[model samples]
Each structure stands twice: as C-alpha cells, then as structure tokens.
Target: MKDDIVLSVVLYSYLDRPIFDVMLNGSGIGGANSYGGNGMITGIRVPFGKQALTWRLDGPPGMARNGETVAMKNPINLAAEQIPADAHYLAVNIYPDNTVEFVFDKYIPDRTPRGDQIIDKSERHGE
Candidate 1:
C-alpha cells in the first residue's frame, strides 16, 4: 500500500443529510493533487511530493439550530508518512446549542489573525 497514490475519504452522517464538504490540495512529498466532495467521497488522487497539504470546509447554511444535534464521521485513508512532520490539521465542530468550535492539531497564537490559521499537527474528534 506504500505506493498507492490515491487517498479516499468517506464521510457518513447520522442525520442522513449533507453536513459539510471538504477540499484538500497540496504539493510536496506525494506531489501536487486535489480532491473535493460533499459526502461519501472515494479514490481521491494524491500526488507525490514533499510539501504540506491544505484543506477547506463548506457546511450547510443555517446548520445550527438551538437544541438540534447532528453527527458526522469522516474516515480518511492515507499513508501516515506522506504528511509533513510539522504540518497541522484543522477541525470544525458544530454543537447542538448553535455554537461552533474550531480546533487545530497545533496551538494557535493568540494574535494570529483570522483566516490565517496554520495547520501543523493535530487530530479532532466529535462527540
């Protein structure tokens, strides 16, 4: 599986609705490649290179409602070594109380401007 250049991510939603979409692209250790989908994606291409990967998220409008809760799970398959040592990951959480939480794999500086968060290292899980 080491030589596999494709990464597949499948997201399942307990609510049976589209919760969010993800886009990933990067250049470096695996190469330059991009993959994007809203739900249940498969066979995303990843090129070989030695750089960091970036991701973006898109969620449904008015997704947050008071006392409403939803569950989403994304299972990603990729080689662990393909990721950069210092690269971080981003995780977004939508709570039942209409609150949003942004979690990063690495600590974010207090003064870091909005829209400029860096991804270095971290993983996120939702309850």
Candidate 2:
C-alpha cells in the first residue's frame, strides 16, 4: 500500500547492553541489542497517518542484570516533518546514551556500475 511506511531499527552502542524489545503502539515488533556490536531490523510495516509512533523498550525476560530491567517509553512525532518528501523508508537508531536518531532514506538500490571491464595498455616507451 502506498500509505504504508516501511520501517527498520538499528542499535549502536559500545556497552554490552541487554536485548530489549521494540514495541510499536504497545505491541512487540522486534528486539535489538548492542551486545552483538550492532544489530538491525528490516521490513517493519507501519500504516501511514497513524496517531503516533510509540516505542516501548524493555529488557529481555528473565535476563535482567542486577535485578534491574531497562524500561523506556517514547513517542516519535510524525507531524513535525520528521519524514522528508523524498524518503521512502525510515530507520530508528538507538544509542547507549538513550539518544534516538531518525533517518529518512529513499532506499535506492546501489546501481553504480562496477569496474569489471579490463583495459589494455602498452608499456611505457621510456621505461
């Protein structure tokens, strides 16, 4: 559907953070963690013109370190021109400092022609 927005999630952090659930509007969509260095989630469908995009982050089940489970709730405002006109995909990047970066991309395929053709050249005459 043209009104559907494709979303993805990425995690970037130096600390070995516990895996956390990614909730959209109070429902779990996927999980992300920094333990594996970097993680990515592709192909999340979000209907356009939604009231709000809420993210509910919670530590994994039964794996809370120090008896403290990480829990955070935030909302992404869609009415603030968060998305660009040329953007067709959205990415949410989370950092250890709880900083979130929303990236808008066109998701265009890399079509730069590869250097595969061999060129023939003669040896330098003055060599």
Tell me, by TM-score, which candidate is best: 2
Clashing pairs in 2: none
The per-prediction CA RMSD against the true structure, in angstroms, equals: 14.3, 13.6
**What does candidate 2's lDDT look like per residue over 47-119, in tens digits?**
5554333333435566445234343334455543556667655555444444444556677322111101100
Worst window of 10 by summed lDDT in candidate 2: 113-122
Per-residue CA lDDT of model 1 for 1-127, tens digit only, reads 3543443333211121233322334321111111111232334455344222222232456645422322223424445474544434333333223232333333221212221221111112221
Clashes of 1: 18
Best-fitting candidate, scored by lDDT: 2
- lDDT computed for candidate 1: 0.30
TM-score of model 2 vs. true structure: 0.46
Candidate 1 residues lying further than 4 Å off, grouped into runs, are: 1-4, 11-19, 26-39, 50-127
- Residue range with the least summed lDDT across 10 consecutive positions in model 1: 28-37
